[model samples]
Target chain A: MKILVPVKQAALVEDDFELRDDGRDVDPDFVDLQLNEWDDYSLETALQLKESHDGIEVVAVTVGDDDAEDALRTCLAKGADRAIRVWDDELGDADPVVIARVLAAVAQRETPDLVLAGTQSSDLGFSATGVAMATFMGWPHAAVVVALDYSPGAATATVERELEGGLRQRLEIDCPAVLTIQLGINTPRYASLRGIKQARSLPVEELTPEDLGLEAQDVGEQACGARVRKMYLPEKGQAEMIEGTPAQQAERIAAIVKEVMGG
Target chain B: MGADRALESGKAVMGGETVEPQTLIGRLLARPDAYAAAGLLAAHPDFADHRLLRMALPDRATGLVFAGMRFSPACLLEELGGWQDSAVQRRLAGNPATPAPVIARLLDNSSADPDVGPRLAAHVRTPTDALPGLVADGRLATRVAAAGHPGAGHGLLLELAGRGEMPVLRVLSARADLSTALLARIWERGDRHVQAELLRAATCPRQLLAAAAHAPHALWRRRAAGHPALPEPVRWRLLRDSDARVRAAVAEAPTTPVELLHRFQADPAQRVRIALARRQDLPPSWLDSLARQPGAWLQRWVARNPCCPRQMLERLAQSAAAEVRRAVSRNPATSAFMLARLAADADPWVRAGAAGRADLYPSVLARLADDTEVDVLGAVAANPSTPAERLAGLAMHDDRDVRRAVAQNPAASAAVLAPLATDPYPLNRFVVSQRDALSLATLEALAGDPEPRIRFIAWKRLGALAASH
Candidate 1:
């Protein structure tokens, strides 16, 4: 069995940020990079699957620069058998769609029996990459999956998905599918010293668009269906505070409710 | 057709020497593993022309060997052109042995089976020119794939970023390589949620900060006030803001002025006052007053404050609230005499807190080690200040936790930890595995323990010691 999990490296803004002189974006110096929290859960799920099954190869892939390699190394330390980093200069401004395309390309090469991805990224919260990857693969997919059980002999998987308003839906699907995992499906384990030491020597295969038979013009910014136009803070609103002794405040509140009711 | 007769008749002359079989099929029949024979036969150059071999081969064997076999671009294209099985086509599409032309043909064939679309889309060999059409495809998945395509054009990205939907904006925001101009535009048009995210960027523009400072959502305002880049004047305004929570956020800002911290000390909200009390810069005199306050929570904060004066700690040691006294006992600044006094407090919790202190006098630790309360004794066993003699004594305690604590103590003598090396509980044995003072002989003994977990730690510690040498 082969499982492919796509991980992302997200940047978090530090409390102190200074905009560039151009007034266009925050200075790069102030951003702190980390693995997306949701992807951490996704990696944990894949590792857990590998633990329960024999001869299961788990591969972790990501689309980012060198910083993303750190995240892949972390996955390796946590028990992923291999790591692939798909990066191209043209993909720097690529949107989620472009990212899914790159991932699909890698998936095609690997032909994993199962693919697991975080439901959403911490930075963008698009909640669409995994679904889109499944779509591109033309495979059955389930989102926000909180529980999973796979029957290898039957090549079927039963999954429980968390829905809005505390609802849950359980569905069974055939193998070779994508499951966008939600948090709390399993507890992620910390990488032990031995694992870290071993991971330092593990080779991470790096692929470019050319290696994937993709051209820059094919998956660059031009292929992105959407782009961010502008970002700004919302206007602040004022709250009305009822200030007085308990009795006076109560009287004021009653008068207001009575006025609305009478009107 | 008898097996014996077939074997006897299989010999033939070939290449001027005696051969097992003259015909390929005949040769395959003589092999022990027919599948291995078929795989080898499938790779032979002349096998394509052998009608009998093609007929004799199973589809699974043909597909597996073909997928794994090397083929020129021209041959792969011709084979793929005639391939009808979706599964086989998918295999052909993914095989690196398959030439680029074949992959391109599959990618460009709009009329191909729907299953072919994803395989082609995912094929690294697929042409980059196909990404734009896929990105604009009617299917949501294909469109998404194109969005992530490394070959996606800039115009397409600009269009996606223009969408008002959160999903589209989220995709756009994740682009670390986005141009500053595009990022600014996204920031301007983003809703409050998007705006809040932009504010989290290390390079958040001043304009965004100004806008967030007055955002309709107090949450946004609070976040903006917490920004390290927040202008001094803007922070001052937020300091006087009506919302206590926002004011509290400002108080928490590292750059918040000392004068403002002093002024906020009088804030009517207890949360705001608590936030102020936590600041290391808070005047010691103020801590003195707060320590005397009637609120147990406030006094508790003062007790935990490292900046809290020794005089204030002395006052807090006598606190009526057990929690406050415990905090005082835990303070590293507490005098040895005060720790001894607290170690004998009527409340077991205060005594336990003192027992855990590393600075407590050895004599005080010995007294606490004999406390009737199990928790106090356990804490004493764990304290580094506990004398080695006391540790050896405490190691014999009947309670597992107390004994476990003795095993974990860094100051425990070899004599104290030797018995625990073979303790009944695995956890006690595990703790003994971590003691630095253990002899190499003891660690070697543990390495052969019955429990695999104990052996693992014992080996790890042994490895660390070996590396140190």
Candidate 2:
């Protein structure tokens, strides 16, 4: 069995970041790129499944820039059998739908038994990618899966999905399905020194739209299903801090309460 | 059809300008301690005239039922039984006035929503006979709720402890009635996670602690080391445990002898030494030496320690590391002169930290209020020591955060806050509503403000004030 996991490197913006002079977006210099927190769980889930099953393989895939290779290397070091990065200038500004289309094209080529993705990325947070990809592939999908048990012989996977208000729904899905992993399903293991050294020597496969037999126009901004018209920081609220000496403040509060309550 | 016709006829009898009788009656029935009115409304002869029965009761009626209002409890129960909303059923289960038979029916209805079962089991009035079934329910949350239920019997708690799920075990451990035998069963059957939790419980038996002291899991060993009841020999053994985390936990434990704590002050691991540095009970003489250490991190911790000599904070205020300086800036023990000096530091974060201290002189705050950094200005606006005049100036600052901080400053007088009460941002108005010191006039104005949330807060404050009086 082979499992395909989609990983992403999301930007961690500082709390105090300010918009650029034009006020369109935050200044890029203040942003630190790191692994998307949710994708870390997805990758860990795939690795755990591989560890339990005999003759099973895990492939880590991403659609990102050169810097994103760091996340792919981390995946390889953690036990993924292979890494693939899909990059193209046209895909730079791609929306979740466009990214899902590109990943679907790769899935067609890889033809893995299952696809795993994070429930949502920390940055952008478009939770539509995995479900849309599953729809594109005509496969059953479940999101926010907290528990999973699969039997290769039976070709069936039992999963527990987290619902709002602490409710859970148990589902049994057929193979060749997509499952978006939720956090806290398992504690992700760190990459050992030996794994890190081995990862450096592994060649990461790079692909583009052309390699997938697609033109630039096939996955461009025009192909995007949605667009972000504007972005701005939310307004900040103030917390009223009571002042005066402890005794004075207490007395004043008492008087105010009396006035309001009409003693 | 008859009810609709009656409602139309009642509407015709009342002028359109006036509130419909049904709406007024529903509101009255929703009031707290309105049991008599509720009973009267329920028993009204005319179907249309009986507003409570004529109109579909709003969701707020659920809260009134749960508020111990005994007016027509049977009628409310009947009305709730006809509704399919699980939320209403959950409320019914919580209402102490709810009759025992209704609760029993809710329990027996297998098709009832999953959430209702746990609430029923946890209800204070639930019979002991019904608890065991709910405790064994397949849903983990229901089982957890049952285990934590105050009325859970010993047998039910023992069953949950035997289940060995971490959540269930943790809740069972909190019960004062949990027998030693049950604790032992949980300790033996539980996985490493459960064992760690058990070690942390104040009620952990001595036998469990001794056994856990030798557990292979370092987390369990580390937690055991911190147990206040651990034998002295076990504590000493854990101090030298192979894991640094265990040694750190032991070093931080107040039960550790002062002599041992002093020896850990120089441990190779910074975490151990840092833990020692944070102990307020550490001899002041030793604190001097720890302060002299070359590590800036150690100096930062010493600067923040409550027992650190004032002289030490003054000295660390000039350190080259912005972090050390920042730590001193926030330390209450730091002298006013040192805080003023740090407020002008090249690093904006250090200055911002200094700007937030209440002890800073008004002159220093005025200077900080003019700093080029918006965060420093924001800090000044938030400081209680900031003069009302300075707050008035900042309330109109271009930076919305600075203005917000000014609006929130408790020191701002009514004159300073009046303009902000109508500030363009609703959040600013919302902040004004939270001030307990606001004049009654201001709160009354905010109570009628356009924003629903602001109005709600102002009204809540008004209600609290009226009740207090």
* TM-score of chain B taken alone, every candidate: 0.60, 0.74
Superposed model 1: Cα runs more than 4 Å off:
A1-263, B1-194, B413-415, B434-437, B449-451, B460-469
How well docked is model 1, in DockQ terms?
0.01
lDDT of each: 0.72, 0.74
lDDT of 1 at B448: 54
TM-score of each: 0.42, 0.52
lDDT of 2 by residue, B145-168 (tens): 787778888777777777778778
Residue by residue across B355-388, what tens digits does model 1's lDDT show? 9999888788878877889989999899888888
At residue B90, what lDDT does model 2 achieve? Answer: 65
Q: Name the TM-score of candidate 2.
A: 0.52
lDDT of 2 by residue, A153-184 (tens): 45779999999999999999998899999999
